[model samples]
Target: MKKSIVLISLIGLMIACSGEKKESTEETQITEEEVQNIEQSAQEIDAVIDSSIQEIDTLQNEIDDLLKDI
Candidate 1:
């Protein structure tokens, strides 16, 4: 019968459209050495920025002293 055929076709379509669940096969991890390297790089960058700021402050003070002399 046409109705039985249509019912069977709908059931096959549903099974084809259903998604399968999959488990993750591998886990990702960060090593201690990588963490230490990142921390060290951050500290070096901070030191460079602090030194540049101090240099700028010193130059500004020199300019102020020169203006006072004039």
Candidate 2:
């Protein structure tokens, strides 16, 4: 009877461990997907920043040219 109890306890522990592992794997997958989405959004924002900088530089050059004419 004692041996059977021990065996049952071990089986229960194994099942619990497996469940925890599956849950952890699912969480990791979700985190990776979120990271990828954030990276893509950051890249889009960088592109917008680059475009704005170019426009500002062009305006600065035009202002400099007008000053030279004065």
User: Residue 42 of candidate 1: its Cα lDDT?
Assistant: 100
Clashes in each model (backbone N, CA, C under 3 Å)?
0, 0
Clashing pairs in 2: none
Question: Per-residue alpha-carbon lDDT of model 1 for 1-70, expressed as tens digits?
Answer: 9999999999999998896878898898889999999999999999999999999999999999999999
Q: How does each model score on lDDT?
A: 0.97, 0.90
Q: What is every candidate's alpha-carbon RMSD to the true fold?
A: 7.8, 11.8
The lDDT of model 2 is 0.90
Winning candidate number (TM-score): 1
Q: Cα RMSD for candidate 1?
A: 7.8
Question: What would the per-residue lDDT of candidate 2 be over residues 1-70, giving only the tens digit for each residue?
Answer: 9999999999999988886343444443467889999999999999999999999999999999999999
Clashing residue pairs, backbone N/CA/C < 3 A, model 1: none
After superposition, the stretches of candidate 2 with alpha carbons farther than 4 Å from their true spots are 1-30
